[model samples]
Target: MTNKHSETSFFITAEEAADQLGVSRATLYAYVSRGLLRAHPTDSDSRRNCYARDDVVDLAGKRRRGRKPVDIAKSTLDWGMPVLESAITLIRDGQLYYRTNNAVALSERASLEDVACLLWDLPQADELEITPSVLPDGWHLLKAHYAKVPIIEALLPLFAIASEDGQTGIWQCDEARLASGAATLLGALFACITGCCPDRHPLHVQLATAWGQGPVGADLVRQALVLCADHELNASSFTARCVASTEASLRMAIIGGLAALSGGRHGGMTERIETAWQAIDPDNMTAHIRRQLAAGVEFPGFGHPLYPQGDARAKALLGSILPDFRFADEIVETMRALTGKAPSIDFALVAMRRYLGLPEGAAFCVFALGRSVGWIAHALEQRRQGQLIRPRAVYVGPDPGSSA
Candidate 1:
């Protein structure tokens, strides 16, 4: 039997589930009996059952792996297993935590600086002495030349100059110096993004000032920054760790993280959501959605695999801002009805930008600024570990012996 549910659904019928697992009906039932998979009775027919597709896929993947070390290592790369340990963040039960504190709740009251201190294991933000580094010579010329470039791209050269001037040689600093450098880098980044000479004012307030926002807008920006601060072992964080594993400078690790985050599938997803919003007709949202669905286009900002229920960050941020933007509210409702998925944080960031009337790339700037904290945390942790992060590759190409 075919899966009658929408393709985006998390459940599948018994036949489809068994096919996915390459198992017989009897084995499928055995799996459910042993608690390897969960089954629910169908609404239309009580006799029929639907299985959790995620569980089935997980089991199938595990069964496909050989007992070789290379096979096991290869499997860990794609959400398969834990490849490394971390003490900074944990994602469990659809909730995100930073060092055992709930990240969502932290967002409610903490500034980005507070979260940075928490992640960096500092007693307080003041301990870091976070003063903005002076702008590199000719910064005005560089800024004017890159006025139209994407914010993420513009950050690379800016970071390179700041790193060269401010940082010592690779991995030579004590923890105190490293932490101080991290704070300085964060301040310099905020200065570059907001076009403001940073001061003792909170980074979020500086952002609000740069964007001409009042008190309420500043609070919203603060909340968004806290929520986006760190996620455990995400692509960019992992890349940061890999760079740090080589005993590179903290600036070098952050540069690697920025490069990874700029990919379309990572923090760059906000740009995709913005592009989709611009391409679709606002007056005919439903028809545009249906047409895009027919063309096999995946919705950019809905659903995160880690949060099977819904993205809590999105729920928290969007809950406050959705009522203000009717078009965004309608799009959220329509996409959920059509796809059985809720908005992810990327969507929430873009929606917040529109509500605040910020510039075109503000969403990404917020993400980069906030997530810089997490990247620094990872780099510091990896440096302490003092192990190179190289993993062996399982070669599947031509055999050198055969000269194929």
Candidate 2:
């Protein structure tokens, strides 16, 4: 196609456009064939083509789904468009922030309750206290029923009980009441997991006491809870928000979040890393790492797509624990030298739990406990917006009349 261009307009040659998209010229031509791009004939020669620099730059951010070019209408779902707007959290520059505050920095000193208030935008000056209470009667039978099951597995029955008992009314509360209820829910979950009554102490101290640790463990638990509090539109958070959008109770919404978090890809990520760490002999760290590398097996905790340089959360948590623990330092240093990649938050959590001699699924439990706060905050936010989060689907199914 012949097109007129102004002298001030920006344009790039075919080679430059291909380089910009990180694709071969043949692939660029295929894009042209698919009408995703148009080649403009220059005044000097029709054979020489020029493309709009703006168009090339825009297309650079797009990726072909699977082995095929995505359908034009559906392509926007792949990071091309904003599905929803939220004022809660942001993931920018490979760092996480809650509202306007830096989450990592806050994790150093803020309790999980403080972070929850920040997330919910509750008045900072108000008394933010969650009174711990004894479980209701016959709860022991309920606890006994799930005692032999995994901690996360037991969460489902408790969720049902809370919903049935109308405890899910927290979502329908005012901002202040909602914050208080959130704290109570978090404390209750912890109590159920450890079989200890919720203490009036700060969440970290309570967790440390329940886990049979001292001051150092309390500090680490605090940091872990703060770090794990919230991430923008993550799988579980999205699930929570979606349920809330349906006018479900806060407990139901959090239950949805917990269901999603239990998947192997989410909080269960730590379990995989812990299993791998358990298999390796730390005495022969180098040899074991090399063998795993040679076998073409990927170490779970070392790499993360969101943080190409490294996960700041991992860096902070590892730095905090490594000085006090020797094996953790060795595992971290060896993994870094071997993979040239830093440990992810998953890896750091498993390392901390192992070093502290916590239970088998402690890492996952810690994550779920902390993330419940975020889920509550998100559900409350979604409730205020009063909008359903339904997205349209493009069907590629066969026609019903097609008998051939």
Candidate 3:
């Protein structure tokens, strides 16, 4: 509660309102500048400003909740529990569970041709309804590393940049620049989110059961890559807007945005990258799981809905070079059996890491790196919004504790 400047009939001085609102003068001004409230210049000198009393009161009644940071690299289930066996059975009976003949006879053929054939098996695009993803002719990484474009351009048929020039007009980043930038950011995010790509992906937790914890490091790296990029609208975006509202420098706003993304909930899932592997330690599945639970942590990376059959990402990546991936036919079958739902990217990557003998921490690193792309895009968009990140809300509150 700071001091007040003065009170007027329809409004209050910036200083007085600041005091009455129980916030710093700077805080009050921030809301005003963000267009959350109306401001009026007081006198000829322009030394003072006044704001509508009602607006001030209304704003005070609305407080925004802090955003949780997003860890895109962290794995989430597509649906409910897919695998529910202990590590012991995963290792022992895994041979029976993982073996699959469905794609077996076909996978042995030439990879490129075989994969092309597999493409035909792909479920109908309209079924997904969200959007049909496509691989832009160039780059090849097993884990669904098709071409990624910025939302602004991706949404447009011509891949044109969104601008304010007019219906048929506008000026923004050109196609070349946007495409190049979008691809680079997305690639980085993928690497960060999952420890590897299709050719380079690791076996995720659900898939990692057959393999030990030794070689999954590369998969963790991919996790970092995936966590690095995503939609531009996230918690960090809000923070970036807060800074940009002040007309602050781009660098400063981005810094603020990054800070917001670092919080848990948003970025928390990234930890699952590492958690998934810990469950697959070769020493003992039951013991490891028990220890993990006692420590208040659960296994990471399993289950998904989009690919109720299995993580298309995993199936595709493994299908690309299953024989070369070095996992036993039985173990693969075991994973398939356990996963009642889709085998998400995380589960596939974790399994690969276990098969390859990579070190620990690779998963988390991958996740962090992957989401960095989305963060950068958001930071850039925040500045472009040309408005502060302020949302209005209903002001329903009970009378002060006992003061009512």
For residues 73-124, could you state the per-residue lDDT of candidate 1 as single tens digits? 7756766544676778877667888887999999999999888888987433
> Distance from true position, residue 40, model 1, in Å?
21
Off by over 4 Å in 3: 1-228, 232-268, 281-298, 304-339, 346-359, 393-398, 401-404
Off by over 4 Å in 1: 1-67, 123-129, 170-172
Models ranked on lDDT: 1, 2, 3
Which pairs of residues collide in candidate 2? none
**Best of the candidates, TM-score:** 1
Off by over 4 Å in 2: 1-82, 123-125, 162-164, 170-176
Tens-place lDDT digits, model 2, residues 1-404: 23467364577789999999877665575455335677777888876888998888877765544324345445535433234567777655567778868889998899987888788776432556656754777776888888888876777576555334445464455654666666667767776767666677787888888889999888998999899999767789989999999988887887899899888778888878877888888779778878989899867778765567888888888888888888778877887898888888888889889888887788888898889889988988888899998866666799888997
Q: What TM-score fits each model?
A: 0.82, 0.78, 0.35
RMSD of each: 9.7, 9.6, 21.5
Candidate 1, residue 117: CA error in Å? Answer: 0.9
Write one digit per residue (lDDT tens) for candidate 3, span 1-404. Answer: 11143343666778878877776665564445334566676654364678777877776665322122121112111121111111100111111111122222222222211221122122221121111123333323322332253211111121111111122111113422332333333333333233233222222331233223332433333332332223223455446556656665433443454455444344334345445554455545546555765787645444542334454445543554356654323335444444334444555544544445544433333333333433334444444556565544333577566573
lDDT against true structure, model 3: 0.38
